[model samples]
Every structure is written in C-alpha cells, then in structure tokens.
Target: MIRPATREEYPHLVDIWLRASRQAHPFIDEACWRARADDMALRRLPACEVQVLEAGRRVIGFYAMHDDHLEALFVDPEVQSFGHGSGLMAHAMTGHSSITLWVYSRNVRAVSFYRRLGFSIVDEREDPETGEPESLMAWSR
Candidate 1:
C-alpha cells in the first residue's frame, strides 16, 4: 500500500535511500553515498513530499516529490523488479499534470524503468556533484 511517509519512519527511509543508492550507482564512489546519506536523511527527505510503499509492516520503497518534480525514488535492493517502484510512481503522479526528474545516465536500469513508464528524456547535462552525465526526463498527463 502507498501512503504518506510518517516522521517516525524517517530513519528507515534514509537507510533505504543509502542502500539503494549504493547498490544502483556502482560507477560512483561509495564514499559519496555515505557522505550524502546524512544529508538525505536530515534535509532532503524532510523537505519533500514523500510517499512510501509498505508491505504489511515493512517499508519496501518510496518516492519524494516537490511540486511536479520527483526528487527521489528508492526501493530496497532486495525488492527490486517487484513493481513497488511502479506503484509509488503511479501514486506520485496522482494530482499532477506533469512530473520531471533527473536520472544518472549510467544507471541503465533506472533509465529504462522511467522510459517504460512513459517519461521521455528531455535534456542531458553533467551532474555537478558527481561530475557524471545525467538526463532530465518528464511525463505529462
């Protein structure tokens, strides 16, 4: 089930973000993820509108968005390919006519996932933080 993330679940959500980020972004240095984990926990997640996918009592995935821009979407690596991401994405798009996000170009799986969901690549640029290529994608209702 998808629902708004609760403040009490913040730590779990941060752990998921770190784990997913480390697992999916191999091309990037691991230390980078470790460093940002704190920021994601204390800053990003709290600042965004986040929704979580819960399976009974456990949170398996989540997506964070602000306005029409999706800032984060992370699913536990153990639960990938099980439609949790798709579920959260559908929920995220509920009240918005359009949504936009940035994905690392080298994260092929994520790029494909977004593509399959009808989000088209609208631009490409280097991510300043990691100095890696990234693509901007958008889906319009």
Candidate 2:
C-alpha cells in the first residue's frame, strides 16, 4: 500500500539507498554518495509529499514529487521486476501534465523501464557538481 512517509521511515529510506548504490556502483567511495534525500529536506514541500510503498511492515519502494517533476522513485533491487517502480510512476502522473526525472546513462534496466512508461529521452548533460552525465527523461500526461 502507498502512503505518506513518516519520520520513522527515514532510516529505512537511507538504508535502501545505500544498499542500492552499493550494488549499482560497487566501487564508489562512501564519501561521494548522494541520494535523493540529500536535498529532500530543502525541497520545502510538506513531508507528506513523498509516498512510501509498504508491503506489510516493510517499505519496498518510495517516490518523492514536486510540482510536475518526480524527484525520486526507487524500488529495492530484491523486488525490481515486480512492478513497484511502474506503479509509483503511474501514481505520480495521475494529476500532473508531465514529470521529469534523471536516470544514469548506464542503468539500462531503469532506462528501459522509463521508456516503457512513455518517458522520452529529452536531453543529456553532465551534472556540474558530480560530473556524471545524466539522461534527462520526461513524459506527458
């Protein structure tokens, strides 16, 4: 079930991020790690703006939205093919005209998932701060 994320859920969110990053980029230095929540507190949106997908007592996925852009959407790798990401994306689009998101150019699975959701590759640019080329993708309502 999807619901607003509580303060108590923050730790779990951080854990999921760290675990996913380890598998996604095993050699990265811990000091260089950055996840969506790094700036979430400064987004100025209500805390409830982000939704958490809870399967019983565990949080399997979550997504944060601001305006027409989806700031973050991640599912635990252990359950990647089970449609949690798609479900979150669909929910984010329900009341917005379009949503923009960035995906790593090398994450083929995620790139394909966004493409299957009708998000087109809009552009690509290097993140000035991180020096990583991010694929900017967007989808219209």
Evaluated with lDDT, which candidate comes out highest? 1
Q: What TM-score goes with each of the models?
A: 0.97, 0.83
Candidate 2 vs. true structure, TM-score: 0.83
Worst 10 residues of 1 by lDDT: 87-96
Q: Flag regions of model 2 displaced more than 4 Å.
A: 26-30, 34-48
Per-residue accuracy of model 1 over 13-97 as CA lDDT, tens digit each: 9899989998999999999988898798889888999899999889999999988999999999999988888888888887789
Winner by TM-score: 1
Which pairs clash inside model 1?
Answer: none
lDDT by candidate, in order shown: 0.92, 0.75
Each candidate: how many clashes?
0, 0
What C-alpha lDDT does candidate 1 achieve relative to the native structure?
A: 0.92
